[model samples]
Target chain A: MTDYIVPVLLFAACAVALRKKENAYDLMLLGAKDGLKLLVSLIPTLILLLTAVTMLRASGAMEMLSRFFAPAFSVLGIPPETAILVLVRPISGSAALALGADLMAQYGVDSLVGQTAAVMLGSTETTFYTISVYFGAAGIKKTRYTLPAALIADITGFVVASLTVRLFL
Target chain B: MVMSWIFTGLLALSLFASLVLGNGSALAAAVPQGARDGVNLVLSIAGSICLWSGVGKLMEVVGFTGFLSKLLSPLLHRLFPSTRQDKDLGQSLSANVCANFLGLGNAATPMGIQAAQRLAKRSEGIASDELCRLIVLNTASIQLLPANVAAVRVSLGCQTPFDILPAVWITSLCSASLGLCAAWLLGKVWRR
Candidate 1:
């Protein structure tokens, strides 16, 4: 069912474009051009955020952070491995993906740890990155309360994913 | 922005810590590698954003966005009250949510940015409460497919990659709801 979404949307879009007598090719190119512009503006922000995040991860800061958070997370039924993914998930999707994949590979995907990682990955977004790029692009200087709100949401996702694994898996 | 400062601090601290902790080589490798990853990240989503944004334009041309806006207006109004008068904002927000629902966040991202820009048009340089809520919604987007995670599972030879759908749904919905509530409450409090 999930696999069919793209194909279904593609067909719908083409059909609608044809029905409306809009030049599908031109419209797509126009959008692609806009996307290019948007992506270009985002590059600087992405580079800075990614550089910091990647450096943090590669420098083993996450390991220290994970160790610090491990005891608290364990109280909530989360393992140390999953704790790293949860912490990184809000900062960078690629990092979270790599950690999630590592978790699945290290512990079978069906295991509780792997399952928790998968659910959390699916449920949350890269909050800080999203705030930066989106707000940065829109030229909004003050982002009051948005960070804390999004982080609250991320924590909920992590807690819920852990509980979901415990109850459902 | 504060985020810039935070990232700068984090990078400097990490580099300093790595140098002191004997992991300088990893940090050294990460600098160039991070730039490459940033480009790769953009490239990875460029095609998806292009395709989705195209589909979005077509949806507008074909009046599908109107239909969608009407269908989702009740809920959209509750979340974004200003959308009641602004069809364009409603349409873009609806498209963003639609893409998110399909687990196409990379696709939804351009739409989310579009919506944020639209919302910002009515305000000064500072973002409005509604715009902040929209950003919060996008960050806590509720995914229906969880396709990427499932794909990773499949690659790892999991028998049922999509088995976590219920978990994803429950967690995402809860978080999104709670996040929205927090945004709304905080927006009201901070405004006064």
Candidate 2:
């Protein structure tokens, strides 16, 4: 963590130096321009997630789902919020992150829930939702097992975040 | 309406499931948490959206993105042979590539959209191979920095947020490589 700034600075420097002919700050500005295009595509996803999140909360369905998954997650040192990640992945990453932060606040850091939320945050990619929205807009006719591979990657990330946090943090 | 209702029911179920893990008292406490989460989610998404849109319009004006896109031209040229190697598509793609590396999801989404839109415009009468390839590439992107992941780690109280940096690069690169391979194979086998 202490050395993070060094790498970030170096990255900025290298990214700048490598493009010596162009201005580094300009690249950043360019990066920001790129960011805007992403904004357009993500609007629908945000709407979907917000609706889903609000409905889920008011309906009291979150509790039931949490109870069903608690035993399994508890065994792994995870709490309710962590289990939400599994369900939340198909919804929206940013929303899932919001929920994860919520869980962290409740369970207190160093608890299983906080750790799991952290890991889930780092590990998984939104599959059914993000892929569909992105590829759909792009006019991709075939997914070609892209979803399966990403799911596998998400699982790997979840497992890694869990074990690493447990052992190291 | 029926499908939306069904989705609403399903969402209700997911919420029900989220709550039962703790005592009912926790649910009351969770109200504020939910509100806070909602707000954060909105802010992050909005921040990302604003940042990226500005970036997109800016790069076009500055010409920096044009320079970067040129480097990928040889590969892009081959894949998108049917479409002319024009600047708009290339610019959109360069912006997207940079956004992905930064872990700016909201920003990447629109550029990806623009790239597709631009390609569609260029393709005119024919469905181009490069366009298909780019979609796969977009979904299976490498995301070199994984800033979001590191930030999550830090917030979770990790001594070092970037401890997973090496691991992320390796995994994302490998996965992206595989995705590219799969895309290539799909393009070849499905070649028309």
Point to the candidate with the largest TM-score: 1
What DockQ does each prediction reach against the true complex?
A: 0.46, 0.22
Chain B TM-scores of the candidates: 0.65, 0.60
**On residues A1-169, what C-alpha lDDT tens digit does candidate 2 reach at each position?**
5376435644644354455555645655666566555555545544555456554555566555687788887675555556766666545565665556556555764566575565556545665665667566756565555555455545545555566666654
Mark the regions of model 2 whose C-alpha exceeds 4 Å error after superposition: A5-83, A102-169, B1-11, B14-25, B36-88, B104-107, B121-129, B144-159, B185-192
Candidate 1 per-residue C-alpha lDDT over B100-183 given as tens digits, one digit per residue, 9 for 90 to 100: 775545557888888899888888668788888888888896876665576567766776777788889999989998998898
- Candidate 1 local accuracy as lDDT? 0.77
lDDT by residue (tens digit), candidate 2, B7-86? 56656565555555443554455555455555454445454344434433343344444465567667666655543557
lDDT score for residue B91 of model 1 = 75
Per-model TM-score versus the true fold: 0.69, 0.58
DockQ of 2: 0.22
* Model 1 stretches astray by more than 4 angstroms: A1-67, B1-70
Clashing pairs in 1: none
Give the Å shift of residue A102 in candidate 1.
0.6
